[model samples]
Target chain A: MITLNDLTQISETEWEIPQSFRSDMRGPVRIFATRELLDHVLTDKSLEQAVNATTLPGLVGAVTVMPDMHQGYGFPIGGVAATEFPQGVISPGAIGYDINCGVRLLGSQIDFETAKPHLDILATRLNQYCPSGVGKDGMVKVSIPELDQVLRDGTKWALKNGYATKADLARTEEGGAFKGADPRKVSERAKKRGKSQIGSLGAGNHFVEVDLVQDVFDEEAASIMGLKKGHLAVQIHTGSRGLGHQVCTDYVREFQSAVRRYDIQLPDRELVCAPMDSPEGAAYLGAMRSAANFAFVNRQLLAHAARRAFEETFAGKTKNWHLHQVYDITHNMGKIEVHEIQGERIKVCVHRKGATRAFGPGAPGLPPEYQKIGQPVLVPGSMGTSSWVLVGTEDSMMRSFGSSCHGAGRMMSRSKAKKKFHGDMLRLELGDRGIHIRAGSMKGLAEEAPDAYKDVNAVVETVSQAGIARKVARLKPLAVIKG
Target chain B: MPFEEISHTADWSIRVWADDLRGLLAESAQGMWMLTGTEQAEGPRVSREISLEAYDAESLLVVFLEELLYLSEFEKIVFDGFSDLVIEGEKISGIMEGSALRSMEKEIKAVTFHNLAIHESERGLEVEIVFDV
Candidate 1:
């Protein structure tokens, strides 16, 4: 176990566990957290896992941990690592089982105060339109051939089917589609799961939240993103559902032998990986990108369902009831990006698990309107707390590979949370605060109680203080729908 | 009880042990059922054949549980017990009996191989497994 004393304090908001701390490590571990926030993670094994991540072959620079870091299966959640492209390995576990699990924010012109009286009905409509809960089938069950198109075209299929708009795709990450997606590389079982779960939200901490833009810190940036203060916005948080999980499962199991064949030694079996150029690695990359594209379409379909609910509730109430796309960002993914490493421009595979990419201003591939402002980073807090909208900074590119914290990391176990809080009581309590709660199961709700996580405000403060991301707006949740 | 839920900050995990590999697999499956709040219906008793192979005991354990999870997800069936169990080298063949799932409280993403190891203990075999939720 690592102690606080082992870390060298770099600043009030930064700390470092040098490479010399471990014998087999190829790089150091840099952590962004205030001393007070550091104490929360010290109670868990997140730091140890981050240290283990430093041992991955072809690791360059350092492994970075955000303020919301928590212990996950292999690589610590809220961790980021980059490896030399085509030479370094890609671990399925590092990208997470959910594949492209991410968040989508839609800015609306509906004023919260003007719509408060009908918020309850809005919550009900959202719950009905967005299919959520354990093992729930999606709204549309595509045939096998059509499912392959989903894997191949992503949001393009949605656009052709009238489930998406051109502007929506323009604001999404990678235009809501990934290149080189080969459905042939995906397993039949995964395809089966994908056909049934394309537009549904799986349970366990996933939610569709309605938030109020209570405060705006950067007026110009917020305006460009169409986030006006005192207006309403909807946030959809989910992923590829069962399909992505199966794809990762198949590859992680196959890589167990790939490691031995390539003479790669890893501390944990979950971190099993293969060189990007190897046959196994190429197969995984193809399958993973296919799953990733499926995830993009999954979110696009849900966004369609959300818009239906919105139109039902506020179409006639407001002059313009439609919601505009602000941004869509994936937290768990492996992207090939070029950055300045050791003063040399190098292409690398940046793996972010429970971390969001926050590209700074003028970064290539950014939309025209956002090129001067920077990429929008959506950080949703637990129910009964405030969510933050931040933008990437130039310093983020140099310090943490242009990544930021994802959310207020869990600090308590689910079983313990259920034992400590009553789900029905928590719902009633939040309802009393003007926040409506719609949940499938009360027991599941207990596991996501507000007290079960760290303070998200503190998390954003750390990243901002560390110069990795800058705050743009603060959102307060008015209605939360959980599965 | 041969299994118990362990404290994990971000995922579901359990520490399971029994006298042998077969016992360990059975106990782990039962433990997983408990973690997901999976309850079996009292309508009927059905049986299904199970066969698997892996490189080692730990991988075998993950593969076996994954088989059960896949069945529950696709076939809407949950196993209650294993009979005619056989473990030869890295292969395990058996017959599992159970009824359809009555209810499930959680969605377990996958059975993971995170630091997985089946080792010896005072009673016999012991291992810890983590599930992504």
Candidate 2:
């Protein structure tokens, strides 16, 4: 029932719903969107949900919604909230059901000219070599015991199994492992569900795309990320799969009671949470970390799959197919991070659902190679559009708690998009533009039509102009595999 | 009754409501099962007993529904309806029967708390839930 009038425009890109709007609100709600995009926000209950998020207990700052914000159960997607450490409550809704759903970018030395003739074969090989579609299984099935180790060790397990290289780990966020993961906290059922689906590319919006670096804005940053104009790159968007979903599902109900026990008053029931120090919170955190770890390992496995596909297509010709990991980042997650809050450094659990971590230069978490520059921000565009590669900026730390927008952001609903556009027509249109499309379902395909999303180029322009992330390179899709 | 779709931006969700606590729970299970197209699920029948504790009526409702989702996806049991339900000191204990865990004909994936509510109204105990797809 909340209306757009409840929000005050802070800037062209920033909107705010102050704490006085509701009695239960502990903070304000901040949204990032253009006037055109606000229409989508107004069409649903997403803006209201964003306002409700301001009521979460121990919320330190405004409940921030990224430009890609949309209605989600509990917290809106592209939402970010930093609650005071041990005292603040951790809500699964804030972290999202797709725990650690994220993207990883691999830059290559080869250019489109070198890869163009073999593009068809390479696309077909990728489709064959990589197991995709819904409920698909891979060749590498681990035993129950081995799976448990993976839950605990994440990408380390993949590295140990020869599925990932040291360089892959070096370029990944947190080196592809969240140290707090405890497999014991993950339920037996979650374990079994994850066993068969470790390397799978599950259905619905998940994709593997081969792209060409179409433009480069910052020469130094582009060089650091190993991007050169016209070079080929790969992007994989997925997550912890069944394990993460189960973990979030398990905790949402758990935190419901925990919220009541603690007498936490929330404007929305979906924002149910408990103090981070409590047993329930600890349990959820442990389980969430395990799932995040699973996602990291899952991507590592998929990367290995991509590598094999390239090798099979090229035939011992890796010199031109030198795919190096640019960066891997999680968009939906809750991490215990130390940040300067009102001049004092305090540890806090930052829940970022559908938002990316844009750590500035000199951040401790960055790898040695990136410390001098900043974290590599991977922003995947809509299918057949331009995706971006950017580096975090110092201003991001002061402005957005070292976070930025995740994607181009949806401007239309699936049903509306399907009604407006035909999947067959879209495939033809994209094909004419030189982008290849392979999918499990055209119905699902129409749901993600590029026309349904905002121009990613514009989104990148906002973040770059706003000084949150410095644009490095822009990538145009060559081929896409969706499930 | 059929499972109903609810609005969720980043994910998908659904809801089911009933009068009594037992019926409310049964309908929630039914809604989730229907969402997953359980009638279409190809698997053998399996049975399991569930016990859950909560501090309040609303949380109890959530826990009850979550247990059903967990059982369906994990244990592969599609419990029809529980025979008995007893509420004591914020705890609800019941027995459910269903089918073996197998590939889901449709992936309901996860249940979410979006717009979740449990209350005693003119219709008795009214409950609503959202599922994350």
Candidate 3:
């Protein structure tokens, strides 16, 4: 029960929970939110979890939380923590069960007006091509050895299998593949789960939407990313599926003993972790990276499916029906990087649970065209709302370790949403608003009602005012496919 | 029913109480099935054996439920009840009887150990489990 009075206001958009707030905290907790949003945050245990996160061994600087922060199982969603490189601890719960759960944006040159008449057909085609919902197998199934290749090669496997192009890989994070993924470290059960779900969008908040770029704030940055107002774009939201879940489950369970053996005490069992240099930590990292790579390939395959749908619906009618990759970014991930902390260049592992990596201009990993503009951060809004395209700032690197808010975080419980809104009613309401809706289950749709989430506009405003990220474009949903 | 859904800001939570550990686990499973809106196909009854061991009761509970989840996802089966149940020390062995799942409304990602603890109440045993959906 941390209240607003317990925090020290740093500025209009910044607040701090001093390390003195708790005896065990290794560092302070820095929060980015407006006064209004902070009131919503106070109703949950998000701040308490942030304080608990500060107790992790080898923590550096302050634990940072974005405006979209909400109560999660272990680490509060929208929280970020950087720990001293090899000596710090990595908690599986901090990075979340959905390893590399992220968003992919593909911009097209076709005008929305030209494609308006076929939106219904496009939704059906996309739903048919992209496998979604619970217990659903993907479009492609692979043998164990083939799955191993996918674990190691990621989007490179997609390229080799004719599912992706060279340009698409360039626009993805870490080239849509992470190094040091050893399949041997992953469990056989995890492998089996990965085999059949290579390209699936599992239910519970995962979706693919057709959006129209309604406005562009940064003309230069938007042009570099191929985003033009009045044109159509597609956003794919999913992750590594059961493979990632089992990997996290296996590690979280195993680390319960590792924490005890290493003499590390935590306030929460879900936050169990091990030293990055220890055998247990190394093994989990290997397995986690493999699951992350599987996710990258998963998104690539979905993008391929999306492209097929686009071509089928728009081809012959429009001159350019192909969807070009804008950017793909993962929110739930831990990456090893070097940062300047307290005037010292220190290597650290940054854990971003429900935060996006928003690398600013001149960052090392950006494609050549994006060097001057910065990395594209796609923030998809709740169903039938406006999504945002933002870019990282140098202030983000300096203040928040190059991270930004993920989305309009959940403000209400799923059960509450279900009780207040009927799925069929919601669909009809959205349809009245001109947004075509296709979902696996109506009840599932009700659980994700728009009112269940915080306002995305306010979230974007908070981060923008905090100087971590800047707006590039705004997108309005035309059609939504939910699992 | 000995179990009911609890309000969680982000994910599903359920509170269950039973006369003992075995009943608690069974009720938890039933609660989970209800949360997912799982339906069974019409067919002959099927029975499968489940045996698992863990370091403690909480761990055993998680392991047991996760086994059911794995079976439901991969083997496409859902258990309705358990028989010949035995809980000795850290090991539990039982027979699960159910039918093939006709359909499931949603997906439960994993069983979380967030503040998971089985407590001893005057009635018997009670516990709260949070699930990542």
Where in model 1 is the C-alpha error above 4 Å?
A: none
Judging by DockQ, tell me the better candidate of 1 and 3.
Answer: 1
Residues A193-252 of candidate 3: C-alpha lDDT, one tens digit per residue: 989888988888999999999999999999999999999999999999999999999998
The residue pairs in collision within model 1 are: none
Top of the candidates by DockQ? 1
- Model 3, retained fraction of real contacts? 0.83
Better of 2 and 3 by DockQ: 3
The two-chain DockQ for each candidate, comma-separated, is 0.90, 0.39, 0.87
lDDT by candidate, in order shown: 0.92, 0.79, 0.93
- Model 2 misplaced stretches (Cα beyond 4 Å): A1-4, A316-318, A418-425, B1-3, B15-106, B118-127
RMSD of each: 0.8, 3.2, 0.9
Poorest stretch of ten by lDDT in candidate 3 chain A: A194-203
| DockQ category of candidate 2 | acceptable
lDDT comparing candidate 3 with the true structure:
0.93
Comparing 2 with 3 on TM-score, the higher-scoring candidate is 3
